[model samples]
Target: MPAQPDLRSSEPQRGGLSATQQALDAQTALLPYALAVFTVSLPAYVWAGSHAPNAVWMSATFAIFAAAWAAFYGAVNWLKKPEAATDLKMRGRVQIFCALIWALAVGQIAFFADGAGAAREPLLLTAVAAAVVVIFFASPWLPSLLIVGPAAAAGPLIALFAQPETRELASLSWGAIALSMALALIFNRVLRRQFEMAAERETLIADRAGMVEAARRLAQSKSDLVATLSHEIRNGLTGVAHVLAAAAGRNGRGAPSREQLSAALDAANDLISVLNTTLDSETAEAGRLSVEARPFDAVNLLRDLVLLNRPNATAKGLELALHVSDDLASAKTGAALADAHRARQILANLIGNAVKFTVRGRVEARIEQTLSGRIAIEIADTGPGLAAEEMERAFEPFLRVERTSAGTSGAGLGLSLSRQLARLMGGDLTAHSAVGVGSCFRLELPYDPEATAEREVVQAEVSTTPDPADRKALRVLIAEDDGLNAAMLRAVLEQLGHHVVHAVDGRRAFELAKAIEFDLIMIDGRMPNMDGPQTIAAIRALTGHGGQPPIIAVIGGDAEEAMDCTAAGADAVLRKPVSVGAVARAVADAISAGRSEPENRVVA
Candidate 1:
């Protein structure tokens, strides 16, 4: 037969039981003692009444038992109080006192058997048996065995010692005492095992509950992700469809202009940007998003953002204004260290949402430095303000508020992502509004006044724009796996008067570069056969290669991917789906920089 499993190894320690359960067990184990004291006193009173010769002695003994019983009952009630349950010292004292009382009662029974002769031997033995039963049920196992075991044996032994003729009764009493002791030991082991099992069961239940809660949260997160994704996809597709339909209408009437085509392309790019932002938000939620701290002009950044959204505001027939406080203007230097790109993204989201929701009145941006040397950018809008309940849940992801006016709908990630980005910069975003009143969203962030002067000196020599006359047409090689992206790059490059060649994969691009002398090589970070880095390494390894033709890496909007490409010898990196202007600028910079210094690589 197989050996039984050891329960002691698997169960929690005996002391691991909860405080409430331990108190309850202690109460349960002591209850029988409380009742036994009162019940056992009745026989003593009856014996004192029947035996007149020793009435005073019996009465005194009965009185003493009654007093002890009263004290014991009072102690039990005292211990039941909530505060008393935690008093270990008091509980120990009470247990000891009760044991003494039990011993004294056994002594009284033995005395009666001796004084009443052999006639009371049977009665005395019966009293001893009753005491043993009470002890077993009333007290914990260890105490019961120590106090009652000897008491049971002592009763009959004393009777036999006083009356030698009662030998048979004494012998039977000894057998009963031994049996009682064995039962007590078995009961203790069982009671301890049961308590341990109860503790283990409680722990298992708690762990199961925690797991259920975790699963519930995971399910909710997935549901939110699905809903947000669907909403965003539908909105993006709808915008693209509208743009295409408008362009088609213009084409049928006469001919669609360059502006019409540009508008359609811009709409498509905006959709891609939205998808990228959603991905970035998910990365932030997973605690994997990285923030870059660099010096930037906060005042100019805010002005550009406001200017960019001015067209949208104008189309809505609403006034858009920028208000910089006197203190900020006087400070002269607006440079601060922060994740400027992320900060701009957050501000843009707020301003865009404000412009979209407000049909009339004005949208205003206010920039100021607080007394604590922190920058505060507040965007206030005269839109249909949010209700109290709506404001409470305004920053919750995927939760969209119903507006009274008609406007473009979104996946409701803008505010949530904005708030997270703001907090990530050691600041916060807060909103205050009432129904029918204008709403204000404030973003506060830490600032460094000392960086401003140095930033101004640096900015003095930097050129914001490149001279168009200096732009040169060059032979550009494009290696991309996506057909649409490849076509777009070719068109954008050709429009700028640059000769273009397309390669379907990294290996094919490497083959093309070897066959022809191209001015610049543009490779996608991910492709078939070889990736961007592998292709870059292979090209650089060519014999007599002088790094003459700079390599440009086109990748998704992941910072890590961009960095990887730069580390792998790419001259520059442009995130997709990039604009025509962005691609043109990158190509021009790569060519110009290569001409100035043949070995130089520009990392963007």
Candidate 2:
């Protein structure tokens, strides 16, 4: 059994609940202490009232004690009860409101003590007062306390000074407050420093964790790359070696019949298929993928993909089916130019995996839009299904599971790379599987808002295969800045049977176009002086050269980048390092289409 993955995850939100809950619990635990402060101070008010000489003074004293009792416990219970837990902003606001109340309660006791006929004993409230002093001295909000406590005390303290008879003997009280204020200030300064240190520590810890995650992800990508390379090289070389070895063994023993040669050829062809697929995957992963977004029918692409996969499924004796929503069909039929190449790659991975795995039952693919506004593709395979363990592991690199009676062949990089490719195209791939119920993989792509067709034309003096009557007898001009690439194309094109000409850049290609009549013009997308598109646009503007050569663009970067190539004037684009056959075919098609009257011939 493969190792199980822990799926519970943490959110990257600020002031997360863990920290807030901790602070709340600490505040709550101090509730009993707050309650005790007012409770103890009750007796202090009673005694002071009894010692009062007049009814007014005695009543004043009584109200002071009651106020102390109510205020202190009110603060306690407020802190104890849970506030708006989900609202961090509200918690902050509550902190300020409660702090203000604390200031008011403390101020009343300080300023009105002598006015309310003086408490005879002040001992009851001493412990809590001292405790509060100790806690607030080093509290994170100590600096703020200096302003609040003093601000609240200032108003009534001024009035108290005017009323000499009531406040004249409160010398000790004034001195104590002045001293507490001084102590609070010192404590606050120290707390500010500590808070700074703690904050720095937290930031350092977070940075460290971020670095660790980055490292882990890099390691995973590297391993994935290695696994992909391993699968490609090992599979290709192994197949090729076996074919050669079998052929050699047969010849050494006895001359093999027609059957052996055919089998050997078939095996060799399989290796070529693997090599092509692997190269495509590598090119994509290496960020060398080229795609042309022309309004092609999505229905057509889907049709081709289904037809290609159906035979494989049939051979596996697994039912294959497809259902494309009408909306999806509408979106596809010459409505948008998407990275249809990438879409095909994604489908290939899905169907390849499906056919590989299922021995009986069925593998199905469905493409439609969800109510949430997304293109959803679901590929489900009914094989032995996936165990809970294997389900998570299935998408991981090189993570092949033990087959149940019958299952897929090869390493498990297909799904992993496929999913990565999906995400790169602004989509997601997800899987659902149970032990005995098979697996369903879903891919969703945000619909492309702009589904414009690539209307640019690619014409070049393309080389043709060895055929006398239809050999490429036309002159083709090649424009490029790179000496080596120019030389290579000259050789490659001449060998392909097309007469080849050369130009260093746009100016040169333009001059050549004017000076000579060429059947096709090959343009490099990125040229120093005048780019292929600019040169082509210039050539089209010219009055001479009544016959416009077809233009084929050779591009190095993402061909799907519409801004670069579409506006660059490419008739039809081919990715960099153009193969002889593809170049020939593109050229044949362009010329056969007709090199008409100085039409737009451009390449970027």
Candidate 3:
């Protein structure tokens, strides 16, 4: 078996070939050398025709045409590659093609020189022919045999019948013919071997690419299978979780044993996690992960990450710290885009492993400016470092070295997902580690200065004393699809003392909007027959509902999906697993904002 690669470290390939370009460059290098050695009488360019009438009019045409054919053959060889070849080699092939044509072109210009054709004809033709014959026998070709074989059998007859110089001179011509044939025969065999070697090298390269492509397709197929199964499982689990909770609630607490209930809940949570991660892996592999770029404070985002991970890090006895580098202001451009959740995942994975592996030593996160003006985020852990072999295999999917803490394990898709996410956002992940020495993982990303300014979301302070004005009942319209989920939601809304009216889906939601006046519309993001956003847009198109309902999107997807709802006229968005208090607050706000001045409609 081949040795496993150290994925954690990639000393980015020398010429920056992202796998595709390197292939083309390899073939380009061979074209020029092939062209130079095949110089002939007639030639012009890679896509152009030959020099002049005189140059190709003679037998020298055969030599020039051979060189031209080789250049075309070499070029097509490179073009079929998966990636474009880069740098000097790409240009060199064209140069050699042009130079060969230029050499033939000079022969044409010499046609105009006085007495040149007569004086140069015998010497130049013979000299060039001698070189060709020498090179042929020295490095012969398959086709050269036809030219050499016949010349050997006809030499003596030609001298005696045609030339008739001195008898001695005829004998010399015969000998010259024999020598030429001997050399050409030997050279053709050598040429045959050289061509075979080149062909083998080409075949090897092609086979390697085929393997890589097959691996890619196999990976894609696996991701699709995971995604399909995850979706099917999740649809089942959503109903199961809610039904179990409802059943447990109605069971008077003691019907099912506490241990049994607890075990069930734990299994549900684990399944949910597996489903979410599988979805992430599948979407990421398909390159379907989309980002919603909104302005949000960089420092605040960092603080949120630290706060969000605080509970887990604390439970693991890990030291988690957040630091901000001041140089993020330098990456000034609308050109830069980073998915905040992706960054969080990338960082969380690094920090999570750091804390999980380090038994007693510290895990620290340090933020600093990268040399390239991008943000450099590092998570370092003082744990047992990896062996040289293990280091390379760390980031590869489904690979775990077993050098870390016993329970610190995952499907191995996490780091691969993390790295690809970083690259998609114009950043890269790299790690530095030595045997017995701690490891440092670094992520460099383009920082957008404007995102911090645009996303200003700070929770408003809540007063301890409830005001009489806050007691107002609000009119709410629930647009949900699943009958069971809707019932669960209505119970929560009705308990909060809000008047609730329900719609089956987007079509019914639109009908409900057209017929009656409501303070708020709790619209489901994904609904058959027009969807939530479409329903909201239809409502917005009409003049008034007496008071315009502030539509809150009950989203089934992530924040990026929520952004699309907001753009389509939703006032706010909440995910499907929204808690009771969150729904009540949304209802309260929408009602207060959309209420008529003095209409007392049981108005909370």
Ten-residue region with minimum lDDT total, candidate 2 = 1-10
lDDT of candidate 1 at residue 489, scale 0 to 100: 85
TM-score, candidate number 2? 0.63
Kindly list the per-residue Cα lDDT of model 3 for residues 1-604, writing each as its tens digit. Answer: 1122222212234223322222224434544454454444223221112222344344454455465566566665655465433343344334333333433333332322112243333323332333333223322322223433443234233323343333454455456656766675665556455545555566567777878998988786687556645554565576456557656786455355566566565555445544555567668776787654434344555566566666667787777777665554354532234665567667767876777676666677777655665667788877787866787788765456775634432455667777888887778998888766788888877855444344332222121323436666668889999888789778877666668898998888888788888877888888889787788788777776622777778876555657667667776665555555556555555555443332111100
Candidate 1 clash pair list: none
Best by lDDT: 1
Error of 3 at 1 (Å): 51
Model 3: residues with Cα > 4 Å off, grouped in runs = 1-212, 215-267, 292-295, 325-337, 352-361, 382-391, 400-410, 433-439, 448-452, 456-473, 484-499, 558-564, 575-604
Residue-pair clashes per candidate: 0, 15, 23
- For all predicted structures, in order, the TM-scores are 0.67, 0.63, 0.56
After superposition, the stretches of candidate 1 with alpha carbons farther than 4 Å from their true spots are 1-270, 293-295, 325-337, 370-373, 404-406, 449-470, 514-516, 541-548, 588-604
State the C-alpha lDDT per candidate: 0.70, 0.59, 0.56
**Residue 190 local lDDT, model 3:** 60
How do all the candidates rank in terms of lDDT, highest first? 1, 2, 3
lDDT of 3: 0.56
- Report the number of backbone clashes for model 3: 23
